[model samples]
Target chain A: MAEPLFDRIALIGIGLIGSSLARVIRRERLARRIAIATRSPETLERARALGLGDAYSLDAAEAVQDADLVIVSVPVGASGSVAEQIAGTLKPGAILTDAGSTKGSVIRAMAPFVPEGVHFIPGHPIAGTEHSGPDAGFAELFEQRWCILTPLPDTDPQALARLTNFWERCGSKVDIMDAEHHDMVLAIVSHLPHIIAYNIVGTADDLETVTKSEVIKYSASGFRDFTRLAASDPTMWRDVCLHNREAILEMLARFSEDLSALRRAIRWGDGEALFALFARTRDIRRSIIEAGQEVDAPDFGRHVVAHHPQTPQPEEG
Target chain B: MAEPLFDRIALIGIGLIGSSLARVIRRERLARRIAIATRSPETLERARALGLGDAYSLDAAEAVQDADLVIVSVPVGASGSVAEQIAGTLKPGAILTDAGSTKGSVIRAMAPFVPEGVHFIPGHPIAGTEHSGPDAGFAELFEQRWCILTPLPDTDPQALARLTNFWERCGSKVDIMDAEHHDMVLAIVSHLPHIIAYNIVGTADDLETVTKSEVIKYSASGFRDFTRLAASDPTMWRDVCLHNREAILEMLARFSEDLSALRRAIRWGDGEALFALFARTRDIRRSIIEAGQEVDAPDFGRHVVAHHPQTPQPEEG
Candidate 1:
């Protein structure tokens, strides 16, 4: 492709996002050398087995030694610890960025540990699947996705450009925004959806009148859509909820108020009110589809039929 | 295929569900002659242009005249009017059923109008796309999905068996349940998800801090998934909420209560509580996939690349 952008790139925490970065780096030849490290020995071995990097280690500090760029891809809750582990090893002038869902919290967690000469930028790639771990990653995960960078004040402009270029090469369009604004936006778009999905699934599970088996059997009705988000990695989502608490709570409060009003409309047989809201929501989906954020295909273009091992084997009694 | 299930079949209300039934009926030879009717003159013309029926009419009564099987596929709220329109024209020994989301309400609305000797059964095939109107119809929409029939005690066994056979031939597995049970199950699995999706999208739209473009750009994170369900036909969903108000309200209360607890957990920074709930929900998705109710692939198996007419053409400023 092009000449390597960085002499060495170290990835801390080899999970879905980390491994996906590794794949894209290798595919695009974005770095002359790639070093990967994870605290979990099993994950480290798995990443090694997957050949996700040129060098692998259990120590985040060891992995970042002499690396020109260090990217952290870990649960939002673990950002501070990862920053502490690798802070001393970053080469001078090296760029350290993170792929976490919450920007404000992540920036607060890691900024203090960044060495004086190092450039620390907080970034979140608005892309992922419900699946996790090294094997779940692919080079194409970031294609056409938005990667939002929330650079701190005094951050080097050259380092920001280089990181943006790196992400652009991996098939992402980068947007620079204030870290606080990023958290608030993500609170509505990301955190709240996951929390709502998880809550609804839990509610369905706990229903006494509607059996769990019936929920599973008839899920194609609408419930299955929520399940995809609910099925996302628990650790990552938990961290998101904990880290982005204030913005998420504000969004959730607004959501509850709106839902309550909706509930009232249904209670009062206000078909017009329900219709108006439903009609209004329809335009948003159209806009999202038009904006290339969503597929226009109905049902995300799922095949008409697919057989899976978990498919119901017998009729419900 | 085998002998036609009905000598004449009338489908009243030629929207997405109705039109889809028309296609599948033609493809599978489910009816010797298919008669389609819609209240909307525009839709009637579109269905005729698409050749979706052997006979087309704007009058529901005229369409059902002499038909051995009458299927009312309008919105749940329209079931009563359609029943009133076609009740007097139903042939002797005809089987009348409907594909509506709320079985209890549909049955309650239509039961009084169904003429004696016309076996009245309520049916809901748990299949569809967010798209609506006659042009969105496809022959395979019902393939491998569930079709639940909530037949009254006085419902004819032979007529129920015939309807079951009809759905089976269209590639759905049939489940017979009480109308109330069907209403409650669907209230949780179908009605609530759409309501929640609509509410969340509305919330996002009303946000003062997050620009609409920012929400649209970053939707891939989690928000886009909900938009699909929220994009579903407003008239249909409105009818669902109006007709299934009690069951839906009950589910909504439960959902709100559960969501409140989740909000508290997040507010308290209880990562363990959030993690436990998050982890529990993943199993349901796995079970749903196992039950053949959902796709196991990530992002609902969306194409890696898809072109939309509304896709953004320029990078953000």
Candidate 2:
């Protein structure tokens, strides 16, 4: 195989994204050594136990010392502190990046702490499962997903190219754009969907007329799909919501506005309008499937035989 | 395997749900003979070509002649007309049921036309994929899903028991409830989730700032989950919104109210509130998985490799 891209790579925050990166880096031989760090000694120990890296450290600063590349994969809200911890320890030519969901907020929080000559590129990979922690990751997590890099204007060309090449090696195609644009795109694509999911699940939980058992029993129709997104890491989603507030609010405004019109159509019994709206969305799913972002598996390939509560339950009125 | 449940079962409407019932009936030998009917000759021909039934016709009345069980699986809006057509030909001791999504409306539309001695039960098999038409169905579509039956006050117990047995044989747990309560429960569990999904996909489709291609390219982040529900058959969902309007409207009102509160919490950067809301939803997903309502597969088992637009595209100011 080709020579390793970096002498040593430091991964700060050994969560889902961080651990996945470490696995892929090791599998693809992208780095000579992997140094993993997280704030909690318990989590650090777990990473060490998993043999996820060449070395493990609880101190973020200590992990980055002498590393040729540093990737911060914490929640967006914690990016600034992580940058501060590692800024003094970063090697002069090391490429620094983050796997945050929001670009603008991450840049605002981390840029000031990024020491001179250490390249700081902000990136958000459009990939993940609803699971978190070190064990929830896999080497194939980045396959067929987009990794977006929002490099600052003054960043060195070679550093950007190297960072792009690293993500490409990790099994993602790279797209380069401005930080502000990346945030706007993600606000609608990622943040709003998670918020809507959480809101709907909350609504179902708070229902007075329908029992919670009923919702749980009948969720396969559609509600269960939302629950997967809502089941995502709480800290990561909360940070995304707080960090990407304005864009999310704007999307929410548009969403509610559209929902009101749909409600009116339903109230007025306008089948034509409802049909048109529903029909328009079918092509989008088709397009997504064709674009390979989604599988066309019927029922999302959920053919797992369900084991359920014994039933043939009859209710006499 | 011992003996079929019915001498001859007539299926009205050969779409997704109807066709699936035919396949399952044939597979499990739930009926000695299956007769299929559709309003459109084209669809009926498609069903015949698929060899889904023992006989097929475009006449709803003719299909039900001498049938031991007749199932109307049309959209809720067409339930009344199917009931009208088959009323004159129904066998006195036969069970009459529908696989509609909305129980209350189906009961209202078909109850008045039921022959004096025939049992009229409304039910919904809480299972489906995004695809529609005869070709989109399989015998296992209802496997491990809930099939809810709402029998009228004076309905015969033997017929209800037979219908319950039929669905159970077809691989579903059976629940019995009144039509009104069924509608209320489904409004939160099924209807609202589909409406929300359609609304969000519509919102993403109409964005001025975000390119449609960009949305499709980056959809795996979270938006693609909604697209599956949004891509559901338009005619079926439109009828559902119209037929179950009251319960749906009430649910929509609740959803909007909860969303507004979530918006407020996000706007003010209430990390604690945001975390609480996000954390609260994770358990619902876990509960659904435990209830056998969802597959606990990571990324919904979406390990399909994606073919994509050639990229390494960079945008510079």
Candidate 3:
């Protein structure tokens, strides 16, 4: 429909985010040629079989060579290594970006290796599923979701605009913030939620009074929601916890403190306090729904769509 | 299509669960006459406006008079009082049931006032959305979900059979569980999850570094899932916490212990432990999906189905 955003786009570590981007780029004709690369040859083979890109390679450097755009979609911990591997081969004018969850760490890891003319923009697409791997991706993952870019102080405006344009074309609403703020924001919204989910699910899994079978059977109540987050890529979350240590720990401390207060309120049977907190949080969900950030459907219609996509979407009333 | 399950059905407490049951019963033609009673007159008026019941009243006793089936769908704390109010008026062969979240509490609270020939079956439909009130209900909320009944020893088999048949007709698979065992099972599966969600969301809302705006904006990352559970009816959850104290506290102890272990692993950077726990939880999610308990779409298809359901259920992918 329009000219390709870049002549050649290199995508490193093609997992859910990477594959989704590849699909959107292909569907929207956002790139002239695509080079898909990952450390795992099996994943590479899968990507090629899916015909996600024009070229597939295990060599990150080879994938970025002569490419106008390089998007790193690996776990946050791998960003530094991938950047190191591709820094030398990246074209002088290439724009380098990432879709890692944590921002400060990604910038620290990739900033040192960028060539003089290469635009190194750190970003995190505030979208994903518990499922991973290339096959789990779809073209519409980014639609109406936020794409946060944490640009450096001296970052080129032209490169920033181009990258923002690319993401917008791929169906994301873009926002730029400082790297530190991004990490702090995500730590509370994403990292803390995942860590807490993993913790709670682990707690339930280890319970002897209530067997795991019971937990799994009645998960629809609320426990299943935590399981989805807990089921996220362990490697990615671990890296996020470690890399975004300060912000996460800060959030964790606040969370623990607030939870202690709640525990006390419950112990004392303080209905008023509990009611106030619960009521306040209800408004937040209303805001989220009104803002179009969440759906009102039970289980978000994911189960229905996944297993019964051919079936008509059920009416609410 | 068939004879109504009950000549007249009375529902006390017109909240999310109550209203949903009313809608389902009406849709399935399970009751010829629906009489709704609630503690709050405001709620009664809302239920009337929603046309949730054929007759609306504030007096539980009056509502249950001459009714063949009376369902108390109030918070567990009010179950005893509602039972006391209606016990004298319940018809000789009427079925008295409740849709409380906690089975043991409901049974204990209402069992004392049960009339000789009337059946008091404690039931819980393991289905809901975060939203509460009459406006939040729909006829299809119970479709393909589980409705658990914890019948006391010596309970009338005929009454149980009729209630089970009614739930089945409303599109729910029914299961019978021992009251105490049901409490323990739901502690981990439902109660504990809600507690954790409320705790984490409260935690996020109280953070000094991460503003509430940030939490709401980037909630799609993972935090939003917790909000759904946290946004649940406060009175319902608070009553659950107070009524199911022992089971909830026991589960909380186990959760805290497990969390300590996870905290240790994170502190020591034990990637293996983190990875193992994370991997194990993933299987639970897979099982949930296979069990048709969870939606399979990425991020719960919240964005795609944000619009109020107007069409027939879309073909499930």
Candidate 4:
């Protein structure tokens, strides 16, 4: 109904996060013209097939030409290359940002190439599904989710406000913080969880004592929850681990130290210590639910209740 | 309308599994009379208030005096104590069973106390939620779930058949397994997942660089998945860890070994190994869904699509 927020906006990747951004931008009329680009021709064509953008390109430089905003949504490992390719092409006054999970490394990778006039802000949107690819995204991916923005010291206030406003319009609550702190926060919250999930699933897959078929059949007991995270896009997660090496390894060290203590408690039959740890963790889940970071449902409310005549199934995504 | 499967069934615990059994047994008329007992007076009172059983008691012997079946659904660590309490009072031809998560120790604990004519079967129902206690359960909890029964040698086939039928009527698919094998399978599928979840959540909570509030706020990114499993009943899980020590320790050793390799790959920026591991785990999730062990929803489909105008949210629980 009204004029779009930006005359031209370019999305440098069109996977789950990128395509979700595209869908929301298009749904809310946040951008009048959208250009999509990816390293892979097939993905670019798929993005075009999904009707995700006004224009599509295999070349990042070409995609960013004259764009009012350039959002790089590629794997964190590729940020430097994407920045290098688009450095000479990004419009003088355009806001250049990213949707990387790790802020410090992404900034380190992209900031070196940014020209003087372009605004460079690294943002991590704390939202996504395990699903990847253009077909996997919908317009509601960012709704009621947090988006953290890490701006450079000399960042233009007008540019930061505009980008903050853009994310808010896309239904995300914006939090501004230091890039290093953002990386540390995400290492614990995102990277370590993914690594632990992948590791445990890999462990189960390799166990001779437990048959793979058995693991698959009885997953509902608990293992399936980890599988959702382990099933995340390989390239995306791999890049995250590689890019956020220092913080991730630190978190991993802490995780292993704690796991060793748990192992000892179990081995020694120390039920008191184990129970205290388990009971304390329940408070965190309650806090997360109270903060609206999680839904208040048992077992994530996945199991449908068909056995009861009076009870209806709970609402789901 | 129809004769109940058992004349009187006594449940020796009033937690999630026990309460769910009580609800389903009533709904399906599997038991004409249900007697619920718990060690804790408060839990027994709560079970009575919820109408989970026809009769309630704080004494295990009093509950099982005239019952045709006695189902011990307490924490695994208390299996021996429960067996000792009910050994003298059980009816001669009654079936004595348990719904513990661990099988080998439960079998060891309860097998010695069974009366000559009574049948003793150890079962691990691969169904539950993160929630615990009487109010957290429902009739549909076991629907379409796997209920594994581990029976001793020289067991009565008639008794096993009747118990199998009881669970079948509760909407569970039954699997008969060796006690040791059941323990091994569950260590990989259930026990290890919960332990890993608890350990990771503990690790996040103890971090010096990241605030606990930040972990709670950004949990949706990945940490929330583990929080669900970590929030499980502390006494039950603590008992499980202690009772199933050998199998769990074996699984934990394997998990830590695999995690080391994964950490090495990340530290060395071995993208190929990381991508391969991540991609392979996706197939396991698909297999679990195909096997009817998991719901095929991304992010457990927790995020409802209130922000989308055209896209409808998928049917949910």
Candidate 5:
């Protein structure tokens, strides 16, 4: 299409996000050669089997050698260890980035070990499904999604532009923000939702009065929605919580306070208060749809034809 | 098709559930003539525009006249008034039912209006999307979903059988449950989830620091799932909260207690407790998939094919 963005790209930790980037990079010819590595040999093997990279290695240091770009896609808690593993071998002019959910912790974890010439930018893709691992990713995962970059004060402008261009090529819109602000924003939008989901599902599971079978059978109402989030990778989310403690705790405090007020309203049978709150939240969903974050089911049916070359188009509406 | 189940079917309150039943009943030829009635004339006109029924009216009394079956699908708060309006016009042997979310209050509100010899059976189709209104319905909305019937103590067996057969024709599995039990079960499954969703969205909206644009932009993580449930009809959900007071309050108490325990675990950084709870909930999702309750996203692409008759089938793996 155009000259490849990077001569060689090294992906350290080939999980859902890494594999997805690998697929997108390969599809768009964004990198000439790709090196995949994870701490676990089995995962490295799985990446090889998936044909995700030109080279696969269990040594993160070996993987980043001579790479023009290195993306660390491990859990937030493991960012420091991954950085430690690859620190000495990182190429002089390489762009070092990460796909950790928490920006502040990732920056704190990796910034210490980043080579002087490397652009160690902290980034988080504001998109993911509940599913995890290599098989759960697809090339379209990043399409029309946001990717936030938290560049350090001394970060080179040219390195930032190159990395932003790479993400753009992978079908993501990029936004730059301070790591602390990104952490605070994501705590409310992403981290807190996952925490609340896990909490609610756990609550339902532990209920002695409401049998498990009943919960599972009648879940189509709303509980099922929480289940999808709760079913997310326990290790990844647990690491997110552990790593982003301050932001998450702050969001949780706010959420609990607000929930208490709601509980009080419900307890007092305040219909007007409940109605007002419920009415206001409807706009958020409208905003999400307007922002092109989700597909309306009927419209999705129509759009599917555009994706599938074999399928004939539906009659005009 | 099978000697029309009812001579005439009157649907009072044309919203998502009501309009869906109308569509399915028409598709399956379960009723000879359909009479649609809603309190708002605009909704009645919209139902007519959608060809949702053979006749449309604003008068509940007029709609129920000579109808062999009457299905009231209004918010729980409106159940009493709808029952009062249609009580005088129900045919002598009409099987009267409702599709309200709350069961105990609906039965309490509707039971007083039952004319002698009219079989009053309160029912609910445990299926819906976040969308409302007549346009949000489809014939297959009820397919493979559970339709719970909470018949009164002195309800006629013959009427129950006929209604069960009617729902079966519309492609739903039917269950008969006591009104109180149904309320409690639904309090955990439906009401709590909606209330939680509404609360979380409200919490996010009220955040002094996080901007609305930030919430919308980064919503794909987990918050977007809650938005779908939060976007549900405010009036309907408000009525559900007010009407199903006792069961909902009880469930809320349990949910809050469990949530507090989770908060404690998180505060203490108990990874084992968090991981254990998160891991356990994964089984429920598996059960739901196994029970054919939800279509996984990948499978949804294939399942949508059932609607397109012109498309050739993809080979099964």
Candidate 6:
């Protein structure tokens, strides 16, 4: 068997990303020892109970001791504090990274704390379910997903290569780009979508003319798709909203402008404009499917998802 | 064996809803014969090739001859024309209904053309996959879904009851509401969601900062869900936007207002407000899942959807 890529991997904040990393690192034999740390004692104990790592500590500094790779997986808002806590402990010449959703903000938050010998390569893995916490994770969460590494200009090539190789071994296709571009790309693809979903769900919830019961009962009509994104972890999304503010605001403004045009077309009975917009969006879904970034099944394959098999009970006439 | 509810059923428009109704009506023995009609020769032939009906007709008027039930399943903008085409031939005692998404507009357009003795009931079945056309349907599409009937003030009770039974037998739980209220409910639950989805996908596509391929490659991060609704039949959505203009506009305005508040929260770093909004929306998803309107699987069960098992193959060292 090939030797593990890292002798020790210190995981700060064992939430969904951290726990999943722990599981995958163990499954792929990417690390010989996993050190899990989280602020909440309850969460740390839960990770211990799940047998997620070889060692567990409530203090992140203790977890990073002698670790070859240190991954900080906290909300983007907390990145600086987490970085501050463990900067003195991260092993010299060790690779430092993160699984944050925002790149530029996280880079800004953590860069100043990095010690001389540490190689900090910020990454954002484009993967997750609408779930959080240690138990909500599995080894397969990163499979066929993209893990984007935003390496600073001065980062060591050997460290970046080793980190990319590790992510590949753990089932992610690795992409490299600068933090600013990564932030902008994610703001459109992720941050804007989530904010729009959250906002729409709030709108639906607040309507006086439309009862909540009716909305809930008929959500499968179209509204349920947004609910999946809306049900995402509140703290994490709030952090993304704050940390990626400018890009998100820019995307939202563009979306609102486009929506105004759509509203105008509807008001004027401009069927051509409506059809043009609706017709063009289909190609993107097809491309996403072909790119292996989405499920090819129609309606996200909701009909075929096994647990919801609602075949009518045989009725005795 | 029980006798079929309708001796003959006429289906106008052989798209997703119409063809699914044909399959389910046959499977549940609700109709002894289904006479399918559509405007396009290609769609009519496709319905015929799919064996979707016992009889096929290019003319809806010809198809409705002596039928006990006539279901017009077309884009909302085309409802009145269909009603006019079939009105002269509709059997006096037959229950005439539609499967349009908007109730009020469909009622206004269709009611004036409905002949005196034929029972005219406007209904919007809260069931469908994003796929459209005859081939995209199945016998079980209506199972465990809601079928909302919007009966006009003068609609006969016996006709309403009979039509309700038909939808029920076809495996939908039926609800009755007035056209105005139904329109408002659907405007929030269905129309606004589709419009917002279309708008967001359009926004993501029109981005200068993010390339189209980048959006497609990272769509699973969030944007892909909107594409499902946006991928829906363009003609159908175009008509829906045109027909449900007022209620849809109201919902869109409300949504935009709420979005403004959310954007403020993001801009000012009001984490509590952002978290509060995000936290409250989860209950709705849970309720929808409990109401059986949504599958409880995380990520719409993308992980469990059969075709998407991109498990990493074992690698030789």
Alpha carbon lDDT of residue A3, candidate 2?
100
Q: Looking at every candidate separately, what fraction of the true A–B Cα contacts under 8 Å does it contain?
A: 0.86, 0.83, 0.69, 0.84, 0.58, 0.80
> Would you list the rank order by lDDT, best first?
2, 4, 1, 6, 5, 3
lDDT of 5 by residue, B78-160 (tens): 99999999888889989999989999999889899889999999998888788888887767777677889999889999999
lDDT of 1 by residue, A1-317 (tens): 57999999999988889999999999999999999999898999999899999999999999999999899999988999999988887899899999999998898889889889999988999999899999988887888889999998888899999999999999999999998899899999998998899999999999889889999998988999999999999999988888888899899999999998998999899989998999998888888888887766577545342533343221100
Residues B88-198, candidate 6, lDDT per residue (tens digit)? Answer: 899988999999998888888988888889999888889887788898887777777899998888889999999999888888899998888888998988889898888
Clashes of each: 8, 0, 19, 1, 0, 0
Better of 4 and 6 by lDDT: 4
- Candidate 2, which segments miss by more than 4 Å at Cα? A304-317, B304-317
Q: RMSD per prediction, one decimal?
A: 4.8, 6.2, 3.2, 2.6, 4.4, 4.4
Regions more than 4 Å wrong, model 1: A303-317, B307-317
Clashing residue pairs, backbone N/CA/C < 3 A, model 5: none
Error of 1 at A123 (Å): 0.8
lDDT of each: 0.88, 0.89, 0.83, 0.88, 0.84, 0.87
Ranking 4 against 5 by TM-score, winner: 4
DockQ of each: 0.53, 0.48, 0.55, 0.64, 0.46, 0.54
Model 4, B263: alpha-carbon shift in Å? 1.7
Name the lDDT value of residue B142 in candidate 6.
79
lDDT of 3 by residue, B1-317 (tens): 79998999998888877888898888889999999999888889899988899998889999998898888888899999889898888999899988888988787788999979998888998887777777777676777778899988898898899999989997888999898888888888888888878888777777777788778878889888888898888888889888887888778777767776766777777778878877777888888877778866556655445533554443311
Candidate 4 stretches greater than 4 Å from native: A1-3, A305-317, B305-317
Colliding residue pairs in candidate 2: none
Error of 4 at B186 (Å): 0.9
Encode model 4's per-residue lDDT on B49-161: one tens digit a residue.
88889888999999999999899998898999999999999999999999999999988888888889999988878999988888888788898898999988888999999
TM-score, chain B, each candidate? 0.95, 0.95, 0.94, 0.95, 0.93, 0.95
Model 4 chain A is weakest, by summed lDDT over 10 consecutive residues, at A308-317
On the 0 to 100 scale, the lDDT of residue B153 in model 5 is 89
